[model samples]
Target: MTTMTTDARFREFKMPDVGEGLTEAEILKWYVQPGDTVTDGQVVCEVETAKAAVELPIPYDGVVHELRFPEGTTVDVGQVIISVDVAPGSAPAEAPAEAAAPAAAPAAPAEETAAEPEGRQPVLVGYGVSQSSTKRRARKEAPGVPAQESGAPAGTYYASPAAAAVQAELNGQAPAEPEAPSARPLAKPPVRKLAKDLGVDLATVTPSGPDGIITREDVHAAVAPAPAAAPVSRETTPAAQAPVQAAPVAAGARETRIPVKGVRKATAAAMVGSAFTAPHVTEFVTVDVTRTMKLVEELKSGKDMQGLRVNPLLLIAKALLVAIKRNPDVNAAWDEAAQEIVLKHYVNLGIAAATPRGLIVPNIKDAHDKTLPELASALGELVSTAREGKTTPAAMQGGTVTITNVGVFGVDTGTPILNPGESAILAVGAIKLQPWVHKGKVKPRQVMTLALSFDHRLVDGELGSKVLADIAAVLEQPKRLITWA
Candidate 1:
């Protein structure tokens, strides 16, 4: 048998373009640190692009050698973020004579010694290492520095090396004391927010998740056994008596400033561009959806539709698909550069979902080909994935039409802006009981309003009106779905 020897080959994993043509992503958190052994296909870090949060998996097995950037740093595509030593037992490559002569060049700059590695290595599909001149800029402050001295703004936290050293010196002269844990408990942002809302201390609760990460269940359990305490009166408190002076006001007490980034930023830019570029015209129609409501109830208890989400939105989506089929001209996009109107044969239906990060419109591919049950299942999975913040960037790309259900929020109707590339978007308002003139009689009926917004360049007034009227007709009479489709 041949013996194997350690080979000192280090591979660098670069930040990839997680979304279609995306240029950058902010490093949210790191799952592996230096000296940690990682396997192939194991997620090492999570990054947030303009579209969604994506977990990147390492393609090769090795020990992590270094993390090039800290958390919350935005890195560009093709820039190396982590280096791994594939062969741990082998010796590292020797540096050049000029680089190694520390005594000879005592005044050499620190940055000159920290040059990036030469050459490229393949890491993932559609992404290979390249010798791009792109580099991460120097942080305003170095790691482990006091926030004020390091030039960090208020409301930000940073570790101070000088403070730690001073504390260590004092501890040597004083009596022995027990050391406290340095790292905080592991928990996601959502879980931490939940714990704060419930007044549950994460450190006191027991973590049952993998790697000691505190989960939502742990926070709920901690809150369940606590006894309700009586409120304290300020007049009877000793601290309240001593502090008669006015308290200092924080800078953000009156107004909060949220950074514009990720999905929210992209959405804002797209809305501004679409509103000004595309001459939009909105048409509204009020229709009685009592029969559609009855069909929704019927589908909920059906054998095939059981365990799936069967709501008015499902039928409303089907109705829009049928309307598009009837008026095929409404399902088209405008190409400004080519000065052409491109009509699509397939329908990629987009559903606007409000996530914690912001609004994201992830679509279903080939939605027109799916049956009612299939559409219901796909809608269920899409909403669930969007809520969990796991919707991929690919899922949100390439759409022909969209639907936004403002009805869920008890609104009558809205003129929604079209998605950047798509031609039309439909807004469905709340279904309410109202007096209607049905069959020459004033009776209470379930009525809803529909608004269709389209790019006037390709879809004229007649086409937009037809699409909206067809959807209203389908909802008014549910049987039209079979005949029209």
Candidate 2:
């Protein structure tokens, strides 16, 4: 055969239409710089959508060719975010060639265009949803772009604060911890919430974490825990308590005040909106989940799932899915305009994730269809991404039902508010050893509380009660899943 040229077709990474017709998103930061060797599935940048910031993992692995937009620049969805040049003779991501499997495959290029309708608004009072991809986004490419020049610092393109610290730690050249002067301190969001709840001024308390950070432990140590017998008060304000801050170095008087902005400010707005507009009706049921806990332990020790956090939370998520299948109404939404119920065939499961920024509910798409292992992995990724402040707005929408694991914080039970669109939210409370009745005798058993809050307008007391009961019953006897499943 005569000479044949095999020039590789370059692929570009387009900004995916994350869900709602989010016209544009700001490039918060880029994780990789030009010329860095990236593999498929590696996170390259963190983009802030309309709702929250999310880490955009690279779908393809190759040398990054170009960055089209600068940090803090707002880029429309379905635009070219980055590009990777596949070397000639290299196999592409998911390429069907047998020879390409021998070496590192080219990066998995994301779908170039999102075929969403140009401009669609959300049915509710908020944003719209995207139904198509943009074709023009796929062709633009930057040739001879400096992908990565030899051992560049982490996040060279974005230059985020956290990336710097990670670079130091990774290279075994971490700088010496600074001599923390300033006897004063700064409080985090949750600590600030604790201060507001207990009427404690945060300015006075000395911060113990890095950069004089106030922690939840600091707040708890400063005040007493809520009394177990007294019910959790649902009042807007806890009380007018003083924020504790620095005591004087010399014998002196002291006073301080912290503005309730940032987390506290945003949280107040969300809680009020969810609580009032949703008309929450909380119902509780106590169940003995001893078998559920046992099954969890078995799964944890199982050979296949040796490394996952297979805890009670995993089982609770499954129980909620079962309930949704049993009582389909629990997974439905209310259409106020037409005055009708919109029953959904799929479940975009929302797990209320509390983060430093605020509360974000990064949901699972078609959650009802996922297997237990898949659900576990999805939950794991969602929680990890949320805590890192990388959950995207698109991942947080079209949720038909929700599950809030309050027990993760040792909370027994509380009525959760309905997410703006969905009608019902299930709160899986802490599971603890408690005394219970079995075979007409009292015994100590593993117990948990199932709290479900529903919109009274659509979901009546009976339907709500049945859904909650169904989840509780599944947990009470784990074997039922084998039959019901």
Query: Highest lDDT: which candidate?
Result: 1
lDDT of 1 by residue, 74-170 (tens): 8887777876654454434344324333353355455533454564322232123322322222122212221112111111111223223323334
**Model 2 C-alpha lDDT per residue in residues 1-485, reported as the tens digit of each score:** 11222222344566654434456666778988878877656778877655666567664445776788888777776566776543322223243222333345453335523244444322111111211232221111113221121111111121112222323444456633433223233543334544665566777675676445566557656765322111121211101111223334544536445444433454577677777776779999999999898898898777755445566777888888888888888788878789898889888888876654456676876678777776776666666656556555545657888887777667898878888778898887788999899879999998888889998888999999998888888998987776777
Q: How far out, in Å, is residue 280 in model 2?
A: 1.6
Report lDDT (CA) for all predictions.
0.70, 0.61
Reference-based TM-score, model 2: 0.53
Clashes of each: 0, 35
CA deviation > 4 Å runs, candidate 1: 1-8, 95-127, 130-252
* Cα misplacement distance, residue 194 of candidate 2 (Å): 38
Model 2: C-alpha RMSD to truth?
Answer: 20.2
